[model samples]
Target: MKNKIEISDLQVHYRDTSALNKVSFDVHENEILGIIGPAQSGKTTLLKVINRTLEFVPEASMDGTVKLDGVDISTMGDIYGLRRRIGMVLPLPVGLPLSIYDNVAFAPRAAGLRSKSQLDELVERCLQQAALWDEVKDRLSTLGTKLSGGQQQRLTIARALSHQPEVLCLDEFSIAIDPVTTMRIEEVLKTLQKEMTILLVTNLVQQAKRLATRTAFFLNGDLIEIDSTDVIFSDTPAQQATYDYINGTFG
Candidate 1:
């Protein structure tokens, strides 16, 4: 299997403190790799680095390399093009203040799609992919900001997918949602996995086990182990730290 993305000796430093330390991993095509750890354990930082947003923060200095689809994004000319290909959904749902229809169409329009019919088709297609079209189609003119928290989050995912990105990075996707809504989002992600690579950050072990093809453990900003979900969950390690964490001795 071809590795869709690879990170080597990855480190992120904020001035004097290191937020990520010597992280390395491969995200295979069409698979979900859960970056799991407690809060402030670098899981979100890892996602930011993978999605290339860490560069946006001026205080962050990254060391080592990250390659996506055999190309180093650092050497790319069009950062927007790269970003469009590898989309990200942050912890918070972000949408324009415009109508829900316009929110989904924003990316395609900015990329130069002008035909109203084409944009309309794109919006529906994406919202359907996000599992939100059925609920919002009748209210296209409504403001996206007016959506409920879970609805807004699904809309954000739709917006990311509208660009036909090859990879989707999500940070804390189900954190603020009710159980039913979280399940709905998970179902959408399950279906989309065939069309996109997924890198997720989740503190919920059950969610990680249910959604990810593989799981990577992050502790004190370090990657301890990465393997298939079953292996990670079923294998007994001699090191008590890993076993203890898995068995609920500690996070």
Candidate 2:
């Protein structure tokens, strides 16, 4: 498989604290890379760093490299274009005041797509991909915030996909959802793996097992284990922290 994203000696610092310490890994094209860790373990920060959102944080600095498609992100002249190629789904569902259809169309418009039919095509494609069109089919004009929590999340996912990103960053996308809704989101994700590389930060252990092609375990802002999901779960040796956490010794 082609390398969709790569981290080489990656590190992030906030004042005296190291948020990510020399993290290194590669996400294959169209594969799922699950990031598992306890709260404040830098899981989210790592994603932000990769997506270049960390630059907005006060006193945040990073070292080494994050590459997408063999191109170092720091060297990319088009940060906006780079971001469009890497979509991010936040932990909380962020809905615009606009209607559901408009929310999904936002990115397309920002990307300079103006033809009504073109935007309509993207809207349908993204909503269907998010498993939301069927639910919102009759009410595309309704406010996205009016949907149930799960549906709102799916709407957010649809909004992220509007850019046709090569890589999708999922920041605990299912954390606020119920079990059944989480399952539906998982189904949508499974379908997504056919075209997009997913980098997921999740607290749910079972989620990684169910959807990840590979997994990375982080503790104290350091990447301790990264391997094929089968090996990481069943065969490869894990760090003591990962072992203890996975075995329920500690969170």
Question: Please, what is the TM-score per model?
Answer: 0.95, 0.95
Best by lDDT: 2
CA lDDT, every prediction? 0.85, 0.87
Query: Which window of ten consecutive residues has the lowest lDDT sum in model 2?
Result: 235-244
True lDDT of residue 15, candidate 1: 86
lDDT of 2 by residue, 1-251 (tens): 78988889988889998888888888899999998989878999988887788989989988999899998999988989989998899999888889998999998898899999989888998888877788888999999888887788889989999999999999999966788877877888898899889998888887998999998999889888988888777733566676676666888
Decoy 2 TM-score against native: 0.95
- Mark the regions of model 1 whose C-alpha exceeds 4 Å error after superposition: 235-239
Q: Residue 46 of model 1: what lDDT?
A: 76
**Model 2: residues with Cα > 4 Å off, grouped in runs:** none
Query: What is the alpha-carbon lDDT for the whole of candidate 1?
Result: 0.85
- lDDT per residue (tens digit) for residues 130-239 in model 1: 77899999999999999998889888888988888899888887766778978878988898899889998887888888999998888887888888888777757534
